[model samples]
Target: MDSYELAIRNTVEVVTEDELKELLKKPEKSVYTGYEPSGEIHLGHLVTINKLMDLREAGFKVKVLLADLHAFLNQKGDMEKVRELAEYNRRCFEAVGLKGKNVEFVLGTDVELNPEYQLNVLKLAQQITLNRATRSMDEVGRNMDAPHVSQMVYPIMQMVDIHTLGVDLALGGIDQRKIHMLAREYLPSIGAKTPVCMHTPILNGLNGKKMSSSEGNYISVADTEDNIRKKMKKAFCPPEIEENPVLQVLKYHVFPRLDSITLRRPEKFGGDREIISYGECETSYAKGEIHPADLKSACTEGLIEVLAPARDYLGL
Candidate 1:
């Protein structure tokens, strides 16, 4: 596929396809995705990381923000703990292959605390209504029923981050679309150019429900091979192709990194088969050409292989 295709594949939406195409033509393009530091970097985070890799291949300078301050504002943890998580999160990101000269890792406090950033944030905060800010953060903010004042400032600060980073495009999961839309609408008013926003789908947890940390329904990069096998064994992989968590793993996580996936089986059960593309794998499963057990096994193996580099980097 071409550069533009690579940049957009598996994405749920690009705010304006025309805008992204235009930006791709420019010689020095940059894109960024911000992550609030968490205890573990799971498959949900990998979706954007994979997209970042694609962008890097497409010749865009990539920026990953370890939003420690944002995590604190979102009530994730105390300041010291959040900052600690940010450092570990950066190492996790690099372990998963988001490193290199073209890729940059920035701490949220490093830039967000600067006078110019704070000034712009305050300037924009004055114009955005409290209700608008709260609504923009509906999907991202934690415990919004009784939100702290810091939560309200989160979205506005995020808008200013686009300008502070000086990136041409902003990449995030679909859950962040509301906040990104807020940025597109308000940043231009602050003299910053409108940002091209790209969003990827949020994959369901292994249980077929929303991916949640408390539920332990997601797979983290730090999972051992046995852990992956155990998780896949229990994953909710329905026969139907749509919304199949295992197939989603193959499509979003596996195929993006591996050229092909082989499903090994006994000779009596259609023997071993090599699937060249996600579409083919999906079709075979839909037609009963591949069984759920076989598909899960293949996905488990593929994930193990894909994460081997990370495991090695982490000495796991």
Candidate 2:
């Protein structure tokens, strides 16, 4: 599939194919995807990583930023724990087959390598008003009262990463859309081309809300086959929820393969399964043509198949 098709399936909000193509035409242009290495990299993070892989396949230079400093700012705790978590996260990237010459992992603290970078971030922060900055507070799970001056400047630092790296495109999840938009808005004022922001849909928790670490609902990237299978089995996959979280995770990541296989094995899998597209799957599912149990099973197996290698890589 082409980049536009991939973007659509990935639920990114680029204005048009021409726009994306123009961005892609700049072969020298880099694409940046950052991860705050505060906790284990989860399935939610994988969706974004998968998108990064697609961008790389399309010939963009991909830079994976380990947001170690951001994590430290947001989730204040022991420094050693933070460092270990960042290291573990770097390994997760390796385990998931994301490591290569094209993808460079840079720690946030590595700004020291170029002393001027942090100053640039502070300058970017100065351009935006408090009103605009507060709009991104929901993303960090903080409010105006709770956020310190440094915390408030986090998005500025992130935007600086884009400018510092000189990326043509910025990749993130929907939750990060605001910060990205902020960067896009402020960058042009500073004479930098506004990086096109591409975001993947957020995978909800098993119960159909956004996934949360504190809620104990996330499935880590290093999860074993047994762990993945068990988690899928226990997931709240009831039919009543309009956006069945399990079904969404499957549609975005699993159902594509199922559609391909179902076309090939109509009789074995079921009747001529015309799930040729995700739209068809969503429609069929909404009409109850496909049972949730069958969908869940297929999702479970697909996730297991996809994550099995990572699990093995992690020696789980």
Candidate 3:
């Protein structure tokens, strides 16, 4: 695929298509995605990491923000704890093939503590109402039932990050659309350029529910081969194609990394077969040509192959 196609592949939406095409022709361009240091870097986080890799291949400088301060502000952990998580998360990102000269890792505290960054954040805070700020953070903030003053400052700082980093585009999951839209609407008033936002679909957990760390429904890079097998065996794979988590994984994570997937089965069950594309696989599965057991088995082995590098890097 060409640069433009590569940049926008698998994305749910880009704020403006014309702006992206114009930006693509520039001699220099940059894109960024921020992550609040979490306990586990699951497949949900990989959605954007994969996109960042695509952006790098598309000739854009990629910035990955390990938002230590953002995590602290969002009540994820204490400063020291979150900073430790930031370092670990950086290694996880690198282990998953996100390292290169063109990709720079920026810690939130590195640039966010500057006086100028603080001033821009406060300036934007003045224009954004409390209701708007609260709503913008609905999907991201922790303990929103009774929020702290720090939670109100979270989204404003995120907006300033786009300006302070000087990136041409912002990439995130669809959960971040509200915050990105707020940046597009308010950044121009402060004399900073409005950012072009790209959002990817939020993948469901193996059980076809919202991915949550508390529930242990998702796969982490650190999971062992045995753990992967056990989880995939119990994963919810219904007959329907739409909203099927197994198919979603094959579409978003597996096929993107592999040329094709082969379904391995015994001689009685139509033996083994090879599928070359996600579309063809989906069509065949939907037509009942492939059984659910074979589908999950293929997904289990494919995910293991895809994550082998990570497993080796992390010594898991």
Local accuracy by lDDT, each model: 0.94, 0.73, 0.93
lDDT of 2 by residue, 83-197 (tens): 6787888889888778886888887777623768866776777778877777775665354566677677778778888887778888888778889888877877667777888
Which ten contiguous residues of candidate 3 have the minimum total lDDT?
307-316
Reference-based TM-score of each model = 0.99, 0.87, 0.98
Error of 2 at 50 (Å): 1.1
* Model 1 residue pairs with clashes: none
Instruction: Report how far residue 125 has shifted in candidate 3, in Å.
Output: 0.9
Badly placed stretches (over 4 Å) of model 1 are: none
The residue-by-residue lDDT of candidate 1 on 112-223, one tens digit each, is 9989899999999888999888898888889989999999999998889899999999999998999999899889888999999999999999999999998999999999
Error of 1 at 133 (Å): 0.8
Best by TM-score: 1
Better of 1 and 3 by lDDT: 1
| TM-score of model 3 vs. true structure | 0.98
By lDDT, the best candidate is 1
What tens-digit string does per-residue lDDT give for candidate 3 at 1-316?
Answer: 8999989988999999899999999989999999999988988998899899988988899999999999999999899999999999998998888997899999999999999999999999889999999999899888899989999999999999999999999999998999999999999988899999999999999999998987799999888899999999989999999889999889888888888889998999899999989999999999999999999999989989989999888877
- Could you tell which candidate, 2 or 3, scores higher by lDDT? 3
